[model samples]
Target: MAKTQKGDKALHSLFAGATAGAIEAFITYPTEFVKTRSQFGGKKEGPIAIIRETVKTKGFGGLYSGCTALVVGNSVKAGVRFLTYDYFKRKLSDSEGKLSAPRSLLAGLGAGMTEAVIAVTPSETIKTKLIDDAKRPNPQYRGLIHGTVQIVKQEGIAGIYRGLFPVMMRQGANSAVRFTTYATLKQVVQGTARPGQPLPSAITFGIGGIAGLVTVYTTMPLDVVKTRMQSLSARAQYRNSFHCAYRIFTEEGLLKFWAGTTPRLTRLVLSGGIVFTVYENIMKVIGNSGEETS
Candidate 1:
């Protein structure tokens, strides 16, 4: 019975994480596209204005540019993160279900590193290429599969992982901070209520929003560097994460690192709220520890 229950919990964590990622990506991907474009430093308008202009100029599909890879990537990444987080957090938890903040942070760190290596690097590469091509006067590689093939044929498998280092850094930090903040918030909010106690979805959602906002801000500079590093074609200019950071700081102005922050913040806050709400609710249905902390 204990073994059966453990199996069920693991399955629930994986499924709930995947479902939450898909739903959140579907809802927020438009803003994600805008965020990416804005980060490239071409757009001067706010997200709303940018959205309107994109719609006006390129039609509705414009907002969904490069969505296929983003959606799939997010699903895999979030699923992996939550699955590993559940596993680690469970191992770190006591019989009373009291997992300390540091333990939670460790769990998050493992989860982040897992998702970054397993899913983020390649998918993000494909997604970034599609979006970057959209901005070019003469776009390369007709679509996702074609683009991927061209990259492989020209640059080999290494091309698909152009900014692997920074991506790992960005995503690793993103999940660690996000999960730590979220778990700490849940611990404080639930306060001796025990693992099964019901907390309002609203509160959980709000806490998730705060976590997402902080994570984005915390990693925004790396995100910018990652974007620049991935958006390039042919030989790369920035050698590594630190070099990319240095050039962006010294050359593009320190403020350049924050260029697309507005859209990113908007997208992340809402998406994070939605992800946690959905994830927790799904965990409730699955009767697993994913929602226990909340």
Candidate 2:
């Protein structure tokens, strides 16, 4: 969706998007944690097993090991995504405020890339390392700030952006798939509705869920590689995203590329539903129908 009318200020998109992302991140964080652990490559553990093991060793709170960074990052990332999408969609849309699917895909790609570079890369590096640290006998960092400092001190600023390429690729494709799917479905669902009329929350959630489900299957390999490339050992283990994928394929077989699918699938579906529903409702309350700006 365009998320704002032509005259809407950029701050509206930022607040609404950040709120939605923070809500989704907190709600779905456990699944996210489990998903990361499962994606650690060479780990054959299923989501349930990972959860059980984490809880056994570190208690239930362990499932939220690296959540603080993600919540903050996701909030900023979501804000950047919506803001950038609104900006690009305005440029790409027709004079009648109609955006073609192709244009929507391009806009989404641009938004994803922006967010990946500005927010995701560094935050993800820290989050992944924190989760890995939790599994160690001797944890290196005390918290998010300390961990970030430690990483920067040890490896320079580049350390916190270890998987930049894969992150960009994965996020670009991910948003392209998701925004296209969601926008297309929203059009279908809103067929014949007045331009400003909003779909029911249930319908919006369903559409978002479907979008996420499709994205999960299509982008699983990229996500797997992204995870591996962001790990603390990524520099020594793999040279780049391609090398990471090659290693996973040759060492662990094709199925390994789908590692963490179940938890990720769960998280994304729920995340989609939560994010869109919250964003739309919040936008409505803020006096915007979130219509595409002409």
Candidate 3:
């Protein structure tokens, strides 16, 4: 019975997370596209300029150049993230199901690393490649499948795992900070509510946004490095993650490490809010249904 319940919980998380991820990805992809464009080596153009130029050159659809990859990737990434987080948090918690902040951070770190290795690295690599390829005079990739196939043919399986280490590090820190902040904020907001009771959607959105806001600034540098490392030109320009970071700092200055902050901030804040709002509400409905059937 205990094992059955655990399995059910993991299934619930997977379902809720995937749904949330797909919604968030669809809603915020333009910002993601703009952010990536800004991160590519060029004059520091504003996000608005990038958007206008992309639209003028390739039509509005250009802003969604890699939407399919991101949507699919985020769905799988969020599913794995929530599933592993629940599993690890359960193990780290006490007998009474209470988890401290430190343990929560550890659980999030483990979840992030698991998802980074399994989902994030390859997904991000593909997405970045597609976006970069789209900017060329004669874009090589016609669409997601062709782009993926071309990359694999040119570079083998390693093509899709180009920025594995930096992605793992960025994702590890991202979830660690995000989950911990979200949990802490939720607990604070839930003070008057009964244990295990769900908070209102608005409160979840606010907390999640705040968590994302904090995470973006804290992890922005790593994100920039990850993007640079995963770009099509990375092999020619960068030896590795550290070398990438060093070049950005020494050549481009410290602020260059935060190349796409504005767009990333916009996307992530909305992403965190939308993802948690959707996930929590879905989970609540699932829980209620389970209780009714049980």
Measured against the true structure, the TM-scores of the candidates, in listed sequence, are: 0.91, 0.95, 0.96
Q: Write the residue-wise lDDT of candidate 2 on 156-271 in tens digits.
A: 99899898998998899988888999999888767766355677888788888999999999999988898898887888899778888898999889998888899999999998
* Residue ranges of candidate 3 with Cα displaced over 4 Å: 192-197, 288-294
Winner of 1 and 2 under lDDT: 2
**Candidate 1 Cα misplacement greater than 4 A, ranges:** 41-49, 192-196, 289-294
Poorest 10 consecutive residues by lDDT, candidate 3: 285-294
By lDDT, the candidates rank as 3, 2, 1
What is the per-residue lDDT of model 1 for residues 234-269, given as tens digits with 9 covering 90 to 100? 245767768878877887788888877887888889
Evaluate model 2: give its lDDT: 0.87
Q: What lDDT does the true structure give each of the candidates? A: 0.81, 0.87, 0.88
* Positional deviation of residue 183's Cα in model 1 after best superposition, in angstroms: 1.0
Worst 10 residues of 1 by lDDT: 285-294
* Top-TM-score structure, candidate number: 3
